[model samples]
Target: MSEKNERQLRIVGFLCNWCSYGGADTAGVCRFKQPPLLRIIRIPCTGRMDPLFVVKALAQGADGVLVSGCHPKDCHYAVGNFYARRRLELVKRFLPFVGLDPRRFHYTWVSASEGQRWQEVVTEFSAVIQELGPNPGIGADTPMETAGQAASAFA
Candidate 1:
């Protein structure tokens, strides 16, 4: 592979502890080979997800962000995933407004027992991110001091 192709993409994965994290663990136990690009963060529940977290990841140069939780109503905390779904959707939609591509962020549901499903989700998302290449970051073309000055002026 060429050096560019051999370079690993940086992907951040936010996984709910009750379901999605377990699902990823299960995939590992099953010896499924998956892309090594994802750096997983375990959250208590999807309800705990904050849109700013996704923004921060992208701003800090993550090539992509993936959020995985329980399957809707099947969330261990009952309504957690539902809230997550709504919040993540807004984040995805708003990304473009901030000069980031919506394709760099994704969300999905995976149950603890669905190891194979986790593998598939990771594989697919990883490929998409790899194709998108590294994220240029939020306002990367703008100088930080200039951007900060503009923000302060607005305030």
Candidate 2:
């Protein structure tokens, strides 16, 4: 296979520090085998997640984006996860509208104590991403004007 075809696709993960990040860490420390595709970004809380972050990631060549945070009503910030749920849902809906596959994005909740759950989540999400293969990030030939227009709509 050509080197380009053999390269791994990028999977970006936005994890809440108090819960999902810790859960992921625990999974690592416990030596659970999981896909190494994900690159994690630890956020203070899910409520802090901006929909644009997902858009930018997709536009910047992320094959898939996984957002994991504290379980509803179990968030350390009380209602942060709730807000994240609302925002992420809307983002999911908007994905297809932007000429991007909605399946490339996923959001879920995982608690800090759920290392096994974290392992399962990553494994499942990674499998789906691999199936989808690499993303071109809006296509290399797309005019800058159109890209800016799409981004500005979200702004």
TM-score of each: 0.88, 0.91
Overall lDDT per candidate, in order of appearance: 0.87, 0.88
Residue 133, model 2, lDDT: 76
lDDT of 1 by residue, 1-155 (tens): 65445566899999999999999999999999999999999999989887788878887878999999999779888899989998899888877666778899999999999999999999999989888787877866666665445434323
Clashing pairs in 2: none
Candidate 1 structure lDDT: 0.87
- In candidate 1 the C-alpha lDDT for residue 53 amounts to 86
Error of 1 at 110 (Å): 0.3
Report how far residue 142 has shifted in candidate 1, in Å: 7.2
> Model 2 clash tally?
0
